[model samples]
Target: MTIAETAAGVEQRRRLVTAIPGPASQALMDRKAAAVAGGVGTTLPVFAVRAGGGIVVDADGNHLIDLGSGIAVTTVGNSAPRVVAAVQAQVADFTHTCFMITPYESYVAVAEALNRLTPGDHAKRTALFNSGAEAVENAVKIARSFTGRPAVVVFDHAYHGRTNLTMAMTAKNMPYKNGFGPFAPEVYRAPLSYPFRDGGLDGAEAARRAIELISVQVGATNLAAMVIEPIQGEGGFVEPAPGFLSTLAAWCRESGVVFVADEVQTGFARTGDLFACEHEGVVPDLIATAKGIAGGLPLSAVTGRAEIMDAPHVGGLGGTYGGNPLACVAALAAIETIEADGLVERARQIEQRMKSRLEDLARSDPRIGDVRGRGAMLAVELVVPGTTQPDAVLTRAVAAAAHRAGVIVLTCGTDGNVLRFLPPLSISDELIDDALDVLAETFRTTTVTS
Candidate 1:
């Protein structure tokens, strides 16, 4: 199919051959080991030769269903014709002319799109960056500059990013924060409304408790921003209870603290809306976005109240390739695809299908302690029967078995017991069913470890 002719529905029917990594991918891995950095640790060994919509064709001709969406990056599907064409066209014309030096229309268009798509209609502005971490770092800088405060607050079990500042904000210690110490100071961790694990405290109560703790420890007056992920990503797919986000938003407004919603993993229609905060009717002061923003390109953005975004001195926030022409073009195409194609509603559809399937599995199997998340971003939390103890062994086994059966599955959570599904909203109903069957079969024979 030409770049212009491939449709989402037509693209999901592709099939797989040879196993995921077959000979071609193995050879590629060997070559990669020789040339690439040793820090790369892929969940699967497949070498993608071609991809479109919800399917990935490996070098060995195996077409595996993509349930992870490239770590939730390709929400519009891989190789979307419009995005591909836009990127190709932009690259041919001009690759780099740093926006800080000479601005471009594509960059402004992207920022405008973000301003409109994000919550709060009262005079919004946006700044683009190269990655989720960069967007997050800038959000903090803007908050600090605007509020003139020294401290920032994040929540427990949060996963912001890997950079020095973000690592300080990030709650996970292992892997992300280990050894990369001497983190930025004055970052505090507060409690979150994780109903599944934290007992005795509901949504509002949890928020109140968090606010009280912050007041006692950091003092809200000294806090510049309180960064949170509406749907906790790397801390596991833990969705805050109904009133947690709303309560926090109100608190931030009352205290003059900038509320930054780190929607890097849950924005751009991934969570059934352009941003997950919309689910709670909470309009954050600043919203940081990245993963799914550009349909697979490296693009991140921070959109917020005009006053707060402009607080930083002129030339205070930018990057050489922050809004690279190619990425900006891809974002425009991706946003167009999301709206024109109704990917938001499509995400809801995927959620309903997966929820129904997984709920049934949970009911039948005592191992599935909880199944949660909204829209296309959903997960199943594994636990010992009749208890809250995490069952990482069964979780690992189920994911491995699914891979063996030709479906890619990803695991997350501090305990490594949650299987998150980030399948493209454009994924077919049949493909969803097939992947579910593989999961069901995987659970049937897997043994649980305490």
Candidate 2:
């Protein structure tokens, strides 16, 4: 449903609802069914008319707390004034010149911002793209060009993208990669240190095992790059143990393999740091960033050591809308807003609140096998009592309960037993408390056996 343009002086917290789907949203959905493709599936029933900092207004006129953060986009909040103004200004001037042909200031400005924001003190260069998948693919290409090798190493439960190369990089088989091969060649998978699942091995040990495999089977010298997610997003919000990242970084240094961190979901302060690599003090040879870079615009970037980035000859990298002025403007506004508004600190605040509340629930409930995450990107892993077997049934029930109670939550995990929380950093303390209360009530009241 199209928004009516909120009434003047209307408060942002109003939740007065005439109907959940309301008249307008249902009408729009019906039209959407015909106009839009059938590949997309929505998590919430109510259609959104408008969204701002931490709340979404449904076409039914109900106000709901935003917890999923648009699948980890809009981390700085939706419709940020700075982002809106920048986009408007750019649209008026010029939208596209194609950076490959005639470069624009906005593109270079964004690349500069990314260089400064990403980890590592070394000389860095950035190439902008339109999506995270594109960034991942380019990262592999750059790694190959730099190392003059063909083998790229990724981890199990990893999700790089939906493209051919990324499909090979991803671990899941049923939907993402299932019927989508013959995939790109020379991609190898390693085991990730999932402490909860991996038998009794510590973080460093997990990294060691993976290193040994590569050394024995593939031989690290032949590998071009090793790509990983600092905090795996689509594979489940899995935070690798303390020494895991550092160990991998050390291995890459010794082997001359480019260490690529796919920070597409964990970057831009979504995980409290400017980048998730900062959590372990591990600096990668390359980094791919997106999701929240432009507040909500389509922008992704590959930033890394200058020599490696430039290995691809001039004009080897770019797209028609690769770094469009409008998206670049949005990115500039987003970065400024993040710095000026202290969203990084805000992310820590959300993390503390989530940890305290969820840990308390874990202590009392056997179904809540684990509460894991860093910063505002957190999750609860559901499992059957006294066993590691995933409790997908309970996870689905609890999600449905939360929706009924007016809070939107999302489920993830290889087994679909993990409930991830990707709340906006700008969301209020009151909203956080309210959503946790709903979660607690859902857990307490829902019957697993039923």
Candidate 3:
């Protein structure tokens, strides 16, 4: 509301003193082109020098309202006071002795917190990792070890990660999996219950269809796990119809298949619930989480049934920097901040507020084909007015215009027509209101390019 420590007392508000990609940012981009790999594409070319609360200060000192939240990693807000303090204290004490070599209290504390917070009350154990992909890969390993199965199933419009095994689990082919294959083996795909495009199919029918396909195709007897994003992230924020997840979980339980929920994007109060699986009351055998776990620090975990997690031989899982002391402390502080701020309820309020505005926008504009998602994670699909034909050209144009106007927005969907909004819970309604206003105006002025 006032000033932020991240920017050395920079006021928390969107103030564009120069063009969005001010000269300084363009300079950095040029430098990046020569120094950094071409594969590392940028959504917003403007480089952020400082960020906190809902604002990202670019190199030219322009304050931009942050809607992306570093791709849902800063759910507790950027450089949050508690997280910063904890990391600072932890760093001064010791950076890392290697958890596997010499375990620390913070890592144990974080595991305890995740065990208590994740969906089920059933006896659970947690193992930390450095990224979402690692968490997912480990979950699969544990599941396979426990079940002695080789096959795994993932759904359409799903994004697991970019690792070799995760790439096999992921559905999209373009940026995530193009030319990078020879992906891992024994990964199968299934149909997802997409409400917007599924001919009004209900959750139960969708689940049945998917279950039958898995039965016929990747027989349950051979399947180790069914990994899914409770709400699909990069493949578009597709919330599979209500009963769909529950039915799948039940089938997995009966079939001796581990149900793995990849909550990388939807965890840590980003959705109204602490974990999106809670919304469906579906308990997963294992849940892989990363984004939003440690403010901006790289930390991920796979928490699940104790017996299954313990199935793998000792030393089968772990990394040198798996649970660095700094990251562990930051995670603890972030969890503390979320509970203290009542961020789960705040995320619900954000969902109501954002959906209200998005619905209003859709009413007047036929291009807005649908508005869906939960908590602070909302999205709008741009379409060709009368039909559900994706209008990707228009989508890209509008997002670029928003960035030019000092408002950050992201686009997803397999078709690239969905605009996702994941603002930090610490963001004020006023910032959201202003950003939406910019989006509305951008939509009004942006002409369909194709």
For residues 101-137, could you state the per-residue lDDT of candidate 1 as single tens digits?
9989999999888888899778999999999999999
User: If scored against the real structure, what TM-score would every candidate get?
Assistant: 0.96, 0.95, 0.98
Please identify which of the two predictions, 1 or 2, would achieve the higher TM-score against the true structure. Answer: 1
Misplaced by over 4 Å in model 3 are 1-8
Cα lDDT for residue 406, model 2?
71
User: Against the true structure, what is every candidate's RMSD?
Assistant: 2.4, 3.1, 1.4
| Reference-based TM-score, model 2 | 0.95
What is the clash count for each candidate, in the order shown?
A: 2, 0, 0
Name every residue pair that clashes in candidate 2.
Answer: none
Error of 3 at 130 (Å): 0.4
**The 10-residue segment with the lowest total lDDT in model 2:** 1-10
* Per-residue alpha-carbon lDDT of candidate 3 for residues 293-389, written as tens digits (9 for 90 to 100): 9999999999999999999999999999998899999999999999999999999999999999999999999999899999999999999988999
Give the lowest summed-lDDT range of ten residues in model 1. 1-10
The per-residue C-alpha lDDT of model 2 at residue 177 equals 81
Query: So what's the TM-score on candidate 1?
Result: 0.96
Candidate that would win on TM-score: 3
Better of 1 and 2 by lDDT: 1
Better of 1 and 3 by TM-score: 3
